[model samples]
Target: MAARTQATRLPATDLVRMGAIEKLTTRQDFETWSFLVTSMLGQFDLEDLIDSTIPRPAEDHPHHDRWSRLSKKVRCWLTLQIDSSIVRELRDESSTGWSIAYADETYEVIRRIIVGHAHTKAKSTWKSAIFMKREDYGSVEQYVTAFRQHVKAANLLKTPISPFCASLLLLEQLEKELPGWTGSIEAGFRSDIAETMTENEFHEICCAAIDEGNNDNADRSKPTSDKPRSSDPNGNTSSNLSSSSNGQTHIQKHRMAPPKGKSARQYVAEWRAHEPQRTPEGNYNYNIVR
Candidate 1:
């Protein structure tokens, strides 16, 4: 019989856009990411590095060197796809959070973020990733960096996204927010870039919303006395701990004043025709930072 021929092996760089996939930011995006990653690994026959079937060998074994090299490459590929915010938190858990011996370390930091008291802070980090944007940081590079720090801290703690925070839901908000924007003016962001607004412009949007809310309150002529005060016979009135003097909700106040541009009323109006995102339906203790 003639000698059997073997096919040549493929390197990672040959996968073309294998690295072009979006960074895994939220658990919402995770399902999609997982699908893509698994597909990519399988295509190149590299799934053994992470999949359950291939048990890791010890250092003394002959296959250990080759396994370690490929495993490390897989780990690099995995980490590179994660946001920086999540990476930082994972670093604390282990430099090789994605252990060459196994894959649990890889997801360990996606499990961190935010450092809000260690675990709580981990969540804060993830929130930052979900709400980060390209425009807010003045540059795409800066924005990506900030996004990663937040992602690193809040691993395994994906939360539901508010409708307002979804970039697609709020796309064209910036362009429509022109003092005289019409017929797609020169200064407005293109629709292609709007999808990223949720990650970046959400802070500014919240400020505009807050201003609008306050404006509505002003029109109603509602007294700032949103809560009752305790008075002593000595003629001193004590403020309630439940609310702020300016009536900030029991949750921490994160008021970010609108930037120098269109009126807050304008931004709010173009978005939802003057109806803003209302919240706090129950005992879910979540605080979104401005």
Candidate 2:
């Protein structure tokens, strides 16, 4: 007679017993939980598998039941993956209470824990996006692009920054670079511009202001007359000498200096300081006015 063949069964490996939970430590808790639930649904009931796989204490131990063992093992796994503070809070709360006997209840508790963590992380991201400021010397276009990226990463579309608020923030930084242009923009912001503008419109406005400022600076640096003036026949070596001298004298008397690399607010303050005295009724005195 031929020898009878015996069937051999292989014991489950550690990888099989742990399932995907072992690899989940590197992922966010919300993603891990989602992947775990989706991948394991057809194989076995998650709660039942967890209860059976986790080791129970000796019979003498007070909390030696399957539920207690499962809870302990779950906590241990979570501690390895998440922050110790979150684990400790979960432990104190006993999120999956002793009364939780069904798989649905276990899943609900776990879902809540993961969702809570996700919410906290999202909130921190939102705060960072809201407080974001433009880098020194950065362009308005660059700043807006960076802001959009941050808002998307933080999942802040539900509470996006208003165009007016974004414009105001951009103006704050632009004021330092384009004081005169920003002063005019500020006046518009206080009027109907704030309500009707979009982020793109604001960006365009900033770009225009920058261009205008550059042109103004270029014009100011150039000589008033490129061609040499013919020599004055009547002992007038310089043209408009009288007007120039009078203007210089007036500037000296009032201590008025041309604005150079100063913010609008600073320049305005200086100009106001040199102005004639005002009456008690807040009106300028014609006698003292320039």
Candidate 3:
């Protein structure tokens, strides 16, 4: 047999750099270019690289062509990463003589703009992801897993889901598939207390309920008795005897009544006689003080 060889993979930074170069050369749309460039720069830590490569000079020089050339190259790269409109604006704004200082400021401004835009887009995506409803036929686990993927993609790892919100969503999903199970789970979870639970805790609660429901269903589907039973002396079979006993117990429970107590009228009269009278000033007068 021939030995198999694994293909070599490129480093993440190299891949990002390649992508950035491709976008710079081919993508004409500003938004696409901006997004790709910003993502690549972040992945490769290009800002830090540029900063370290061009340190500030202690004294200002009348002729600093070397620093000016490096700054120009950096600016050119940034311009290529954006739209033509932005390029025109940058050229118009580049009235100041080029220097290392000017380059640093320009890079910082561009970085901030891209980072801000990225954050806004991310926030929107996260909001939409979390608010997504469960699909008609999708399982709770599948829906939750998809929501988690969305959270991860939106870079919301640190964002904590409110327990109240988590529980509400879980209950909504559960109610659809396991009607009365929600009530059983809710009986254990006091609204105020459950509201304090995290999303993970609520998810565990949902899983437990699902397992319990499955077990209950399995138990109900099981055969009650496989063996034949002997008839009683009265001609009742064992099954009939068991059913009668159950019916008698149920009857006794329904037939039971409340213990004898004072009559409602007498009780009300007694209560009235002992009740404190309210004065004109809204104070209770136990002794009926004038």
Candidate 4:
């Protein structure tokens, strides 16, 4: 047996223990539509193959026989990539919405790992002329002899990694370390982009909202205000969307004149009820409002 060295074997375990080995588990949990999976994964299983027998997408569509055009494996991989990237971006601390800081630090670590060394790896190796030392290997030598392969066999080194595979691995890395990070990440990611804007920008947003002639979204766009008090000189301001700083309504407030006739039971009830019916001890009990 070729003797294993401390340098190679130790780093391999560091990767495997980190759950990087699960990156290759591409067997999807759900059975996807045949034509779709083949178009995405570049390969397909027997079930997928059988389903594509029926013709799909009208012939006039640019990709009329898309099912036939793409291999099953390609289709599967593409789909996986989209899902995984979305998961990773949303789960990180810097993501918008739910501004509460994460209770765990894994997202911080993962973000650093991806944005720093991994991004520079290719250039770092190539600029140093390391590939010249391994000239017997193929042109894509950086991946052909990657460090993680000794611990786990992954096709990450393959040319044009299926977006799905890249996405899947990215998601898998986050999932392994962060555990419950997906829900928070997804919440942050899928939310409206406005969530990420600064407070001053949020003020400008309110001006934009008033310009839109809709207060329904004013809170999100404008500076938050303290709850208006009923007894204040403003005399019960209109809905924030319609209310002006002077407490005047942009639209006329139609005050109904007192009913011309009936000092009837309804009117009597309102007049008498103006002061809530109080208890024997003189405290108001809200149950009487009914």
Question: Please, what is the TM-score per model?
Answer: 0.31, 0.30, 0.31, 0.16
What candidate 3 gets wrong by more than 4 Å, as runs, is: 1-117, 120-129, 147-160, 209-290
Residue by residue across 41-96, what tens digits does model 1's lDDT show?
A: 77766655555434455556655555556656677777788778666656765764
lDDT of 2 by residue, 79-110 (tens): 45445554555465465463234333443344
Kindly provide the TM-score of model 4 when superposed on the true structure, using C-alpha atoms: 0.16
Say which prediction, candidate 2 or candidate 3, comes out ahead on TM-score.
3
The prediction achieving the highest TM-score against the true structure is: 1
lDDT of 2 at 284: 46
Task: Give the 10-residue window scoring lowest on summed lDDT in candidate 3.
Answer: 2-11
Off by over 4 Å in 4: 1-62, 65-86, 90-121, 128-290
lDDT of 3 by residue, 113-175 (tens): 333335566677668656777664245566655654554444432344555565666567667
Candidate 1, run of 10 with poorest lDDT = 2-11
- Superposed on all Cα atoms, model 3 deviates from the true structure by an RMSD in Å of 20.7
Error of 2 at 206 (Å): 4.6
Error of 3 at 181 (Å): 2.1
* Candidate 4 local lDDT, residue 62: 43
